[model samples]
Target: MESSSALALSQLPYYIYPTIPNTNKNYPFWPAGKRRSSQLPTRLHCNKMFVPGFGEASPEAKAAKNLHNFFTYIAVKIVAAQLESYNPEAYEELMEFVGRHPLNDGDKFCATMFRESSRHKNLALRIMEVRSSYCQNDFEWDNLKSLAFKMVTESNTRLMRDYISETSRAETEK
Candidate 1:
């Protein structure tokens, strides 16, 4: 008298049936005999992750880094300006060298500057080294170099006149 669909439905697994709500006082979801452990496992050590040399530096270290970066920047500007004004061919050669080497950071810039045996490059490197014993800051070497290059190359004589007057005034004051 049972239909085929009814038989098939009855043959399905027990878990397929929806859970019935338990209304008994002694038993909750679990059966009467079984009980889960109440206490959780204790952690033996801290869960915090650490990385070496990735933490903040001391105030003195930070100041030294800033000073180094400042001097490097000034040296780069001075070199570019001098080359642009005094020797156009040497300035072109320097730009070509920079393009080839792609100085991305301070250390790379210093190394490349020294590697090339040019008077301007040597002077610049000497200036930077005398200012700072180490080069750690990953300053924008390419952009700064190009900016200084363009500033001196594109500027009119008026700026130079103003700079001369300012220097003379400072000399008088001193």
Candidate 2:
């Protein structure tokens, strides 16, 4: 009879397990399946990217890489800010992308500085001010500025493409 009962239990589609009491006396008031706030997954505070040759590169090479990252980060910020006024949804998506993407120390520093300066009423003036402060020389500043412009153009293009595709899809649905 015991063997038959055991076989019957095994054949059941689902079995309910007995709930065990929480063993930790420290959190006696806490509910089951709940965790402390400190145990939760924390969001990254900054966007830091990993450059392949950064660690082993010469000082000059490292500086060049940092400059490139800084301009790229600034470009992304500029594009994101532009989108915020015209298309909030696209702006949100861009911000999410920025949040997810990895950046290096240089990029993080640029982002932090930009964030601070962006509080000013005139974004263009602040950007120029930041450029002046960071860029080593006029030629270097011009080159980096061009790179930032190129990045903004490319990002805008991609956003436009996505917007067009979405419109087309809506049209098709209609």
The number of the candidate with the highest TM-score is 1
**Candidate 2 lowest-lDDT run of ten:** 1-10
Candidate 1: tens digits of C-alpha lDDT, residues 31-70: 5444444322222243333334535875557655665666
Model 2 TM-score relative to the real fold: 0.30
- Model 1 ranges off by over 4 Å: 1-56, 100-104, 118-174
**How does each model score on lDDT?**
0.58, 0.57
Please count the clashing residue pairs in each candidate, in the order shown.
Answer: 0, 3
Candidate 2, residue 4: lDDT: 26
Q: Which parts of model 2 have CA positions greater than 4 angstroms off?
A: 1-56, 105-174
* TM, every model: 0.35, 0.30
Please provide the root mean square deviation of candidate 2 (C-alpha atoms, Å). 21.1
